[model samples]
Target chain A: MAWNLQSDRPIYAQLVEQLRRMIVTGVYPAGSKLPAVRELAVEAAVNPNTMQRALVRLEEEGLLYAQRTSGRYVTEDNEKIMEAKEAMAAELISGFVSDMMRLGYTREQTIRLLEKKREG
Target chain B: MEEYLISCRDLGKSFPGCRALNGINLELPRGRIIGLLGPNGSGKSTFLKLCNGLLTPDRGELLVCGSRPGVESKKHVSYLPERSYLNDWMTVEQMIGFFKDFYADFEEARAYDMLARLAVDPAKRMKTMSKGTKEKVQLILVMSRRAQLYLLDEPIGGVDPAARDFILSTIITNYNPEGSVVISTHLIADVENILDDVIFINSGNIVLCDSVENIRAKQDKSVDMLFREVFRC
Candidate 1:
């Protein structure tokens, strides 16, 4: 999938989030090699320096790790990936509940609506 | 010899009607893609022109690669002005040849490679090409140079969204790692993600200059949004 970055947030953060998603979703599978900085920047249409910063941040967070000679790679730690995925799902659900609340629906009503949609 | 790509001390410039730039002082580091942002009649173009040695400041010292804007400094800078300066009769191939012959740092293969990616035929003359194609050709020639600084004036102003992305990609991928680029344009959102730093100017004065991330982090606003709030008429 293409990077669908919003204009409101910091691009570096968006990139890090997107790359993390890519890894968590197995788009870049565990132990898979990530593209070079320039190539990634070209694909995302972002500055290489900005892309490098995002990659470095991801590396620090253990979602990615750098080899001495070869390029970066997705972390092989399945637990860490699972944790990230669960965290993302929690965030998505939280946002959905809050948005539904703003539209005058209680948490119970929101879940009921979800269950009804699934059943239908 | 210079510590910065371009440094100025109390730099100022003017035309017959009014001042274009006033007492601007800043230092641009290498390996950066800086957005020179401002509204119409702002000093963005004038600032870029000073860096390119096309316009001399009226009051203050301006340095490019440590020396004054002259023959030695010109060699280190590649400039793309807002208007086209290509010969109408020159075909795309011939234009590339002219650039290769004119600029010692120009890369023929890179220029051709960019043209190929854009599907621009080398046989098309400048006069026969669309406005967008002509702009792309100019951008290709400018980016093909292995110069120390690239001063681009509104490079994506007239291009389509697809072309704009291609041009921006070309810029980020092809620019020399050791050099700096200053892009002056009104399309803030289009270019914001690609910029490392941004210099916000208004009415001949520099209002802000900082890293793009810092702006978003500190102000909690996008550069485009902050720009509108800052430069609202």
Candidate 2:
């Protein structure tokens, strides 16, 4: 997954969101080991402590768990991943719908526009 | 673990008629990347010089590694001065050797490895290498030391974008995990991504000290943008 961080928001929050997307999409599949914190930090070009904080947040969310000396792994619970994926999709759709509404489109019009696009 | 790596209290320094640092009180924790940011003549260099023990405060105390910057603290602090002190006659290898002889923490292998990565030949003399190469070499030498605190003064100020990226990545990968790094630069946008916290120093006074994430979250702006707003003349 790309570590496309921006300067406008907290980096660790971005990392956590991106990592959640990665795990849900099976980029780092269920039970697969994650890279070490320092390695991930270097790849993302962020402070290791920031990266670690993001990972710990993920752990608390039940998306990842660390083993003693063996490093972290994505949760084996596929159902949990599916739930997270659905939640993120809902968030994206809600954002899009609200933005469309602000542009003078109704909720029905927003869905109709998406339906029209899907057929083409 | 109980104390800050570098602590200052009512620290004051004056040069001739100029006040370089005034009533500075701050504490830096361990294992974080901090930006010492300000515009030209903002006393960034003077503050770092005091931390390196190159200049002593005229009033109050500035402590490094729990004590004043001295022979013992120098062992834990690796500094890259803003200016290159490379002898015109010496080769890169000789410089590394000199550092190795001077600092017990210096790692010759690590220095050579970074030099190779930069494609800078160790056998080349200081006079032959370009200014950018000399700066990179100096950075390599400073980072190669396993020192607890790395005080880099305007490290990427003069390099090209590609070289700037290289220098930053080198810093991230090589810094001692138990130590802290305080980078002083006016180039905020370039280093913004890597810094955990930033100290805004201007006219020898600290205007702000906050985490980068906190600033972005609360202020909804990059440190670079905030710096312009705060230090605009």
Model 2, span B172-205: residue lDDT tens: 8875668999999988989988898999999999
For every model in order, the TM-score on chain A comes to: 0.96, 0.97
What are the DockQ scores of the candidates, in order?
Answer: 0.75, 0.76
lDDT of each: 0.90, 0.90
Q: TM-score for every candidate vs. truth?
A: 0.94, 0.96
Window of ten residues with lowest summed lDDT in model 1 chain B = B169-178
Judge candidate 1 against the unseen true structure and give its global Cα lDDT, from 0 to 1: 0.90
Which candidate leads in DockQ? 2
Candidate 2, superposed: residue stretches over 4 Å from native: none
- lDDT (10s digit) by residue, model 1, range A1-120: 798878778889999999989999999999999989999998988889999999999989899999999989999999999999999999999999999999999999999999999999
Q: What share of the true interface contacts does each candidate keep?
A: 0.81, 0.74
B1-233 per-residue lDDT for model 1 (tens digits): 56798999999998998999989899999999999999999988888878777788899999888889888888899999989999999998999989888889999999999899888999999999899989999998999899999989999988889889899988878756789999999899999988999999998998999999999888878999999999888
In model 2, the Cα lDDT at residue B49 comes to: 92
